[model samples]
Target chain A: MSNYLSLENVGITFKTQNGPFRALDDVSIKIEKGEYVTMIGHSGCGKSTVLNIVAGLLTATEGVVLLENKEVNAPGPDRAVVFQNHSLLPWLTVYENVRLGVDKVFAKTKSKAERDEWTKHNLKLVHMEHAMDKRPGEISGGMKQRVGIARALAMEPKVLLMDEPFGALDALTRAHLQDSVMEIQAELGNTVIMITHDVDEAVLLSDRIVMLTNGPSATIGEILTVDLPRPRNRLALAEDPHYHHLRGQVLEFLYHRQLRPAA
Target chain B: MKSNIVRLTPQQESPPEESTAVIPESASNAASTATRATKSVEKIPASTTRNYALWRASGTTLIKNIFLPVLTFLVVGVIWSYIHSHIAPEIPSIADTWTRAKEILADPLAQNGPNDMGIGWQVLYSLGRVLGGFALAAIVGIPVGFVMGMSENFQKAVQPLIQILRPVSPLAWLPIGLLLFKAVNPSAIFVIFITSIWPMIMNTAAGVKAIPKDYMNVAAVLRLGKLEITRKILLPATLPHVITGMRLSLSIAWMVIVAAEMLTGGIGIGFYVWDEWNNLNVPSIIVAIFIIGIVGIILESVMTLVHRHFDYSR
Candidate 1:
């Protein structure tokens, strides 16, 4: 399969009061079309920096990001991002939040009825159609994240970039929404790159899991392909014979091979 | 509550498992228990009706939230009436003030000439000046605040100048304003502008600076245009602070307009009060004072309501 997205030797250095601090060092990755990839790392390991670079939020100090064989220079409607806090504008109702993407990119091309229909379809896909009239503040965190998901999905983006979308959720809620995300991804078959800290979550939802080292400057430590059967259940995945093996290997790579002492 | 629910059923009822096993031994007791259970279930709907009614109740729920200020006003009025009747018997009573208020309302400028300053005319004049000065401040302050907020170098360079201007009182500027404007009203308005704009600009700059990195990241990722981002993201994010700055600006503007009028000599409520005091009409001065207070309260409430419109994240 042809790679739909490519990050070539991407590096980021932030200018601080003291001096320039390198956040990411010559990191590179290629993601295939319809790939569901999870980027796993410790905090400040530049996982989010990488995601932002790919999303065109930040220009890399070196190298380039390619989307569909074109250089990615800025954020566009074609690539949507779901933030960690589920940054649904609190002033807007669920319908309005999802319709924001539609309004931004598709308002000129589609009728109001068409837009409404599309919004409902995405909301229903995330099981939040009942909440379409409610503001983000009125909903629970899980529901807000689901609305964030629905908003991203409604864009019909070429790539969906998520920065720990479920990080703030309760364990049970996170798992439930993780499965919901997987189900939607399966239905839509869009490319997704999610930044996360949870190892089991990365394994359960990803086609491949890429782990990053600790940072003053960090790079991808290892990329592991998840060979688990499709339609995976989290409970069963934990009990699966291969689960322990993969988990052990990843933990070793994260805590042993790329370990850094406390600062 | 769970155990209470489980234990509350009549003991004579046949065990649920045994009955479901297709062999019931106590048919008569079971029937009575079922009837009793039906009665309890019927009561559940009545309780739910009470709950539904409770759910429908709307608006303020506490004295502090709703009626405390009104009660305090009543208490203060009672004390004022008592003092007027006994301690200062010659002082005008609330009744006399009410009559004066009505007369003032009937023909605000009647006591004076065609251009004589009526209470209503004085209030309108003061309000106009306050609004004019506050509007000018908002126009100049908000944009400067946004620029100072977004640029670190600009913030560092300009911050000291802002600090120097902040401590200079509006009253202190009155003479300079009069010299600059060469007109009493414009001079007074200028004082209002100076006093009001500083806090507004500073607060707005602080609010803009406090916008989270995550929000900027989202803006960048979405590739939102600078204009679009300002309107859609930055403006909304800083709304609470902007509204707060506006509140501070308006109140300061109101106060400065009165002070400026006292210094510059004008046809505003402030000048009216000073004029009445000079004539030794303490009662009219008192009335003017109360009117000023009432107007300030009204203006503040209006600003608060407007603030509520933008405070959705709460």
Candidate 2:
């Protein structure tokens, strides 16, 4: 498989008042083109730090992130991030918020009309075309996340970095978003790196799930390759024995092997 | 997910009760709760009833708002009259103050001397000076505040200097203004300008600091240039605070102009008050007080309206 995006021993250390704090260490992963990958671990496991490193929002102290044979040193439109809070400029309308990124990313590449159409098309993908004129604050949390997804997708990033994209959402909204994401993945074949805490979400969306050990310095504990077939249905998976086995392995790793120690 | 729960009803009823156990994801469970929420919402009072409820609440609030203030004013008037009759025989009664106010208001454009402009002209002069000073403060202070917010080192290095200057009375700046400008009108304007600038600078900086790191992260991920970030993100995000700062600065501007005008001795409300006191016309002074108060309230109301217009989240 082509190593379309690679994290070669990527790590980061943040300076706290106490001292230098090691957040991630010796972490590495290679992602193929059009692959959907998820990083799952308990809270404070530095999962988001890793995603930030790849998105070029944080500079890795130890390793380098390579995308399409180029160094990733700074954030660019090629690595679009869908922030957890939906970071829609609250001042801009939904159409304008998405259009802002589309305009910036396609400044020279597309006409104004083309950019507007592209923004609308991406919003439609997330079923948010109806609320295009509304502001982020006017929408429900689910709807805002949809717009956030649209904004990220409109940029046509090489790898979509979603930091706990659906983590704040209710389970139903999450499941709904997950299913739509799977459908969109099949249609667009865009490489995506999502950080999620939900077990079913990790299993349901990822082609590979990277589980990290609990942190002071978190590293990849295990990488589980999901063998579930395409067009995977959540309800159908509930009864599938192979699905149960895959779920059980993840549960064992998370619950038994890497269960969070008490304070 | 709703259908999932409804379809499991047969099993739930059969006492095997292992039906809910079959569910693996909380996704379906949340669906039931959401459906129940929608069901409860459907059971709410109709639109007209809700509207009536809303109207009733607003009506009572409006009455309370109007009633309490009127009651307080009446009490104040009664106390003023009592003080005039019994406690302080020298001071004018509330009725006398009102009559004097009516007379002064009746002929507000008259000017008897350099220090004795009519109340209308006095207010207009003060307002013009306040606005001029406040505008200058906003123009100079807002950009400085933005820069302070962008750099913590600058904030740290400069904040101590601001703290030292902020609390010095408006009068302390009066001498400096007079010394620098060598004229009365500009001196008064300078005093107002210097005194009112601190709030705008501080508030604008606070607004900038209050902006969520997520927004900056969004800007970065988009590879937005500095200009794009400022125009698209920083300006809009900081505007409400800027307005709040301006609101505060305007009031300070208004407040200091009275003192500034008093010292500068020009054709303004402050000078009119001082002139009336010199002439032993306490009633006209009382009228000036009321005019100053009403103008302050009107200015504050305008600022509040503007703040509300810009601070829209939804």
Candidate 3:
């Protein structure tokens, strides 16, 4: 399959007062166009660091991130990130936050009317059109995340980088939002790379689940293909025969290794 | 998750009591006790009454929290009046202070000296000076603070100088201001400017530096232009702290103005207080002191309200 984005021999080392800590180690992955890939790992396993590298918010200590055959040297509108905390500007209304991205990336290209229409369309897609005038503080956590997703989509990014976008939500809200995001991704046909810790979330939402090992220089431990057919139901997926096998394999690979001593 | 638990009821009942076998003694006793309680509830049909009691408990907690402070204030007032009447007649009772306060208000212009103008005019004059000095400080300090916060090189270069100047007394700037401006009002304004600026600068810088990293990431990914990001992200993000700083600075400005007026001897409430004290008019001096306190409280409260108005989040 042709690749839309690629991370080649990518790694990161953060310099601290104590010493340097390697966050990622020679990690390489290729994402195909319109493909949904989930990176599942324990916290501090360099999952977010990898997403930051991909979003060009942080540079890799080694290797290159190529998007559509071009190197990503800095952050650009081609990749939009939805942070775990839903970093909506509390001062701004929901519409203004989404309009922020549209105005920034498409100002020279789109008219005022077009921008407004685009913002409203995206808000509507997230079912936040009614709350467009409300400030971020006035909305619930779930609504804020929806606004964040709307803002990311309004950028019309070629690749969407989601760092545990639903990690903070209640399970039911998370599940509903997951379905909403999946439906949107399908509709928009944009490549999505989501970082998550929930095994069921990874299995239900991704074409491939990439698991990373524990840190002190972490790398991809295994990549599991989720053979379950879409559109997925979390309840049904839990009961499916393949679901247990896949869950067991990932759990064993990630945790069982921790029980073994160094070679 | 709620539905999941509810849907598992049949399965739970059909498990041949396997879960009971796995349960330890303490847990089984707890569950059995809870089951007995639920059966009792079913027999009585009084769970709704228990729920009503629970609701009342929450309501009582809410009312107690709100009423407690007001009750404390009333009790304090009674003790204050008792102490005033019994121990020291020299001490102004709350009613005496209020009467004097109302008398002053009834004829503020006449109570104020003919040459002194009115208390109203003095208040306005004092307000203008405070605002002028504070506004000047904000205009100059915020941008400097933003730059200092955003750039490491700039922060390192200027930080030591700021730290050195910040601790210098407002009076120390008075002499410099007098020499530089060569006029009483302007010099006094300058002193107020100097005295009030450091907090605004320091607090603004702190606010800017403390901005969440996630916001910068959002700005970067969205390709927000520098101007847009500064307006939308940087400015609004720092506003709460900025308002807090301004509140602090306004009080400082009022204090510095009073000191400045005392030193400079101008037509201001500060000067009025000094003038009354110099003339040894004890009652008017007392009046001036009370007025000053009241005005200061009002100004502080106004700033606080403005701060709260803009501060949406808890």
Candidate 4:
């Protein structure tokens, strides 16, 4: 089968006051349809840069990004990004935040009722239907992230991009959201590219973990395919030897091989 | 009250279970609290106790917010009375001013002529001018600010002019306004508009420039059009700052209107005070000063309410 999404030697250089800054260099990855791929690295390792390139929020300075045989040049509804900060408009309620994107993408194609259904259905998927009337300010951090996910999913994007969606959340909230995301991915079979620093998270969710080297010009250091079975329980995987082995590989790649320089 | 507590208890119990069950310990802890609350309800009528707690809380808040301020005002009044009676008898005594205030306020809408109108008419006239000038500033200044914020070149071009002109006195603009309009009313409004426009423009520009990058990123990823971006993202994000600018502009406009009216010799509180000063009516001038202060306070409080309504960052 053809690759669903591919980045062919993508690199991004930002011109800062100090000088030219190479955030990513010669990074290439091929992701198949329905794949849950996560890019994991240290804080400044250009993992987010890779995701942004695919999302078309940032243009690659050197190489090209392809989605289903088309060049990814600008942000569109095809690739919906769940920002790390859960960037829900403060003035909008949970329902309105989700509906904003839903209406934008589906207003012409679908009826008002259908669009509303899509919004409510997506919020239901994230179990955020009850707090639909509440604004982002009124809700907790975890709820806001759930709404962010709902907003992204409501677009029915060909590829879902999440940049540390649960990084700001507490451990329990993170674990719960991770489980929800895993279930959603399984059910929808949509392609996903998530950026995270947590190893256990990467192991738990991703079909493939793409590890990156430490930066100035970061690139893919290793790719580990998680061979674990579906509906992977966190408790069950805690004791499973194969899970540990896969988790250990990611840890080794991140810590031993690509150790970040001390500031 | 009883119904409210009963309704609140179930809502408080269910949210943690649905949203926060990832931390089962906290979930169960919340459940235990709900049970404990039920037990307490059986021991004592929950409504009465909750009502007492509510009453106590509100009582304390009232004391802090209202009573303390009133007490401070009383202290200031005593000091003012002492100063007027002992230090400078030429300055109207508090009692004398109170007497004049009573006489003037008894028929506040009375109009013998344009020059000899009641205190109410004077205050209303001043307020009308302030609002007129303030509205005009908002109409012109906000858009200018939007342009300044959106375009770096425009901002660079206009910023120097704003800085140079902002500190010039409102009275300085009066002559220019009189020359251009050749009318007292429009000139006064012109002075008010010029004085107030700077804060609105500066604040709105700063606010637009300070929009969080994350929101802009969201706009980009969603492929939102320019109009949609401004309507959905930019406007709401800048609302707090815009309201702040409006508040500053209003207070400055109020301050400038009085000075402008005093120069223009119109039927306003400022002109009324100046008239009283000329006639050596110290008690009437004192009353006018109090009215000016009270009106200023009311305008500021109204702006504060508006500010609080739009302030959603919390």
Candidate 5:
């Protein structure tokens, strides 16, 4: 039986000049509606490849991906992404950057005023209402990422794909973003698939943390469930043993089992 | 009650990031006290004077910016006078050239006949042709550049053709343009078109290539239509580069128009310069040279402003 979003035996083999290099193999995940999942691994472990396949930005050579019980073939607005570097268009103001997606995706459903309201609403959701007129270049990195999240959220996609959304942000900024994301996710109940290297981030944000082994042919090594109760306050969770246990399991999987030498 | 200690945001706290303007307000406060304490420094007066003092601290700006350039111009005049006195009788002296330039300026819009039109008319005619050719080149080349950038196979297929055609001289294209259009004006315009299009295409394509993959990925996720992508993403992203291409193309077109009009034998600065040579009017030819340089500077400055407006990379 298929889940809300399912990747069954998904794999990719790139045709490089050297030869065919297998990046991922036999990777499968079944995501339910409103489930927040984080994929964690070393940099080259096909974590992004897996995310890409689900988002239909990359086609899996081996198997199928079903989103809302339909075959996922090419990229669509249904799988809106928050890119690592906060890919807000530098040329457009923060409002227009989000509105660029909002205008296109909601072209059919939303009226002009409704669309405008929706754009402002989404920008407000990310605490970026004051900077609506500023270009992406004018904003801070954390702020840009907030707008990136706002842009993706405005689409109201079936699945929100974040490829290391907080990777480029500072520790404090990352915590703020993580908290905001948690707050947003709790309110909206949006299905999220975030790829991250931070074990604590994965545990804090995800209902389940899917760990992957190192590549040549990377696949899911283990899936660790974080059974912590929410609204999971980071300060409160710092003292919670269950949060520590869940974090430890993910850490054990990464450093102990899936260890690769520093290149 | 207001707080005694002020908190600085990270932006303000970072000394390296602080703009020079910030230093002035703080310095002015200290400068006011210093001015009050000492009557000797009172002659300088306000912030403008303080800025001048700061300018002195930097040193050599006045000499480098103003004095040196004036000195250079005087040196050039001296050299021109020496050359006029000794070597080339064909070359007019600076004063004679200036007088001829004044005569040309006196009746700039005179329309006596086709060949006996004023210097302004010739310049205008040349400008019209350059603009036409430059506009056509932009309309054609910018889209071609976009196509080349968007498609790898197209870029590869067309790269060799562009390389081969780009280096073919403006004079060489003039003959081809004459044969094709079989008209003098169009032929000159065509030479400008051929000379200018390469930089536009190359620069625009480079701009398209320089865009980060993340942007296209955002487009992909949005499922932006081809037209929407162009309007919302591609066009704006490549605009600064397009302006740069236009700037380069305009300058080249300005340079080539003189040669182009000379070859085609038409109404332009190029033709004027050539006709003045035929008449042995060396002073007028010197004036034409100055006109060419002036027009080029104006076109270049306008385009540079446009480039700065669109340049998001900075």
Candidate 6:
């Protein structure tokens, strides 16, 4: 598979009150077309920093990021991000929030009806059609996250970026959303890069799990490939030895090999 | 009868049965029998008791909210009467003030001339000035506030000037307004504008600065145009704070208008108060005081309603 997104030797430094602070150093990763990759690490390990770099919300202090052979210098519709907090505008209804992205990305090329249809279609993908008229504040946390996902998907982005999108949700809700995302990925075959702290989630959803070391200056620690069959069921996987092995491998890596001192 | 017996038996038996299972059955039998007998006798329906509780709750709330305030007003009236009868006679008794208030309100809209207009006309004239000045302040203040909020350097440059000007009494500005405009009405309005503009500018700038980083990040990621960001994100986000500023500005304007009008000598409630005081119509002056208080309360309550309407966070 051709590399659809690549970050080469990416580094980020912050000028804090105490002087220069390196958040990430010499971070490099290549994400292939139609692949679902997740970056996993403990807190403050620059997992989100990597995702932000790809989203073009942050410019690296060193190296370069390329998306489809184009330099990723600024945020655009091409890379749509589902933020950790599900940052839907409180004043807007679910439909309007999704429409905001659709209108911005497609207004020049698409008709109004086409944009509306696209918005509705994306909301339907996340089963948020029922709440299309409800404001973000009126919905449950899970429903808000679904709307966030719909908003990202509506942009018809080249790559979907998620920064611990289900981190705030309960375990059951997170599992249900992970299943929905897996199904959506299977259907659309869109490239996805997600940042997560959950080991089980990394094993369940990702084609490749890129682990990062703890930071003051963090870098990629290891990469693990999941060769599990698609259309994976959690209950069935609970009984599968291979699935258990993958879960164990991630646990061992997180706890034994690359565990943060404070954690 | 059978269904009633069934329900009562379970209700009466379950607790004792469970307790008997834990303890000795023979030991609790007499106590259980006594309790059952009392429970059967006192068979009030659950719904009726619930309804009674709800009614009592609402009655308590009504007494707390309505009755207390009315009682306080009556007590204040009694105290005022006592003080007028026993203390200095210059302060009009509540009854005397009420009588004068009735007389003034009876022909409130009557007009002999600009100098001798009714209380209603005076109030209207004052309201017009306050609103005009407030509207002008809003027009000028909101944009300046936005600019200051959007740029730190601009805020720093403007901060010292605003600090120096803001705390200077609105009455102090009256002389400057008189010098600049050389007209009573415009000078009164200029005082109102000067006083009211500060709250709007300060509150709106603070509101703009407080716009959450998450919303800005969304704007950045979406690549929304400058106009779109301002219209969709900035305006709505800062609206509650802007309304709060407007509320403060309006109350300040109302206050300054009374003092300003007293100095300017126009057909206003404030002027009416001064006129009554000059003629030694103490009761009528008291009536004017009550009217001023009532109008100020109304203005504040109206602004509070507007503020609540724009408060999207709740």
Which number leads on lDDT?
Answer: 4
lDDT agreement of model 2 with the native: 0.86
Clashing pairs in model 6? Answer: none
For model 2, how does the per-residue alpha-carbon lDDT over A1-55 read when each residue is reduced to its tens digit?
6779999998889999999999999998899999999999989999999998898
lDDT of 6 at B12: 30
How do the residues A131-208 of candidate 5 rate in per-residue lDDT, one tens digit apiece? Answer: 999888667889999999999999999999999999999999999999999999999999999999999999999998
lDDT of 1 by residue, A1-263 (tens): 57589988988899999999999997988999999999987787889999888888788999899998999888876788999998887777999888877777777788999999999999999999998999887788999999988888888899999999999999999989998998998888989999998888888889999999999789888899988888888888778879878877778887888765763
Specify the poorest-scoring 10-residue window by lDDT in model 5 chain A.
A1-10
- Name the 10 consecutive residues with the lowest summed lDDT in model 2 chain A: A134-143
Displacement of residue A234 (Cα, Å) in model 6 is: 1.6
Q: How many collisions between residues are there in candidate 1? A: 0
lDDT of each: 0.81, 0.86, 0.81, 0.87, 0.86, 0.86
Residues B1-314 of candidate 1 have per-residue lDDT tens digits of 32223433433333333212222323333344444554666777765653343333211222232365568779988988999987987567787877767766777755465347678888888999888888898899988899888998999999999889899887888889778988777877788888778878888898898888767765665566889889888898888888899998898788777777776666788888788767766677678888888799778878887997888764
Cα deviation at B277, candidate 3, in Å, is 1.8
C-alpha DockQ of every model:
0.47, 0.72, 0.61, 0.82, 0.64, 0.63
For each candidate, give its TM-score against the true structure: 0.80, 0.90, 0.82, 0.91, 0.87, 0.90
C-alpha RMSD values across all candidates: 11.7, 10.3, 11.2, 6.9, 6.4, 11.0
When just chain B is superposed on the true chain B, each candidate scores a TM-score of: 0.75, 0.82, 0.69, 0.82, 0.82, 0.83
Supply the TM-score for candidate 5: 0.87
iRMS of every model, one decimal?
A: 2.0, 1.2, 1.3, 0.9, 1.2, 1.0
Instruction: Give per-residue CA lDDT, model 3, range B100-188, as digits (tens).
Output: 66765776655345455767667677777888888899998888888888999999999999989998888788888889888888877
How much of the true contact map at the interface does candidate 3 reproduce, as a fraction?
0.89
In model 6, the Cα lDDT at residue B60 comes to 56
Ranking by TM-score: 4, 2, 6, 5, 3, 1
C-alpha lDDT of candidate 3 relative to the true structure: 0.81
lDDT of 2 by residue, B1-314 (tens): 34344543432222222223223233343344445544545745553464454345445544555566679889988888889999998799877888998989888998888755678999999999999888898899999899999999999999999999999887788888889999989988888888778989999999999999999999999888899889989999999999999999888788888888888887898888888888899999888888898899889889978997888562
Which docking category, incorrect, acceptable, medium or high, applies to candidate 3?
A: medium
Ten residues in sequence with the least summed lDDT for candidate 1 chain A: A254-263
lDDT by residue (tens digit), candidate 4, A1-263:
57789999899999999999989999988899999999999998888889888999889999999898899999998999999999999988999999999999998999999999999999999999999999898788999999999999999999999999999999999999999998898899989999999999999999999999999899988899998999899999999999999988988887787777693
| Global CA lDDT computed for model 1 | 0.81
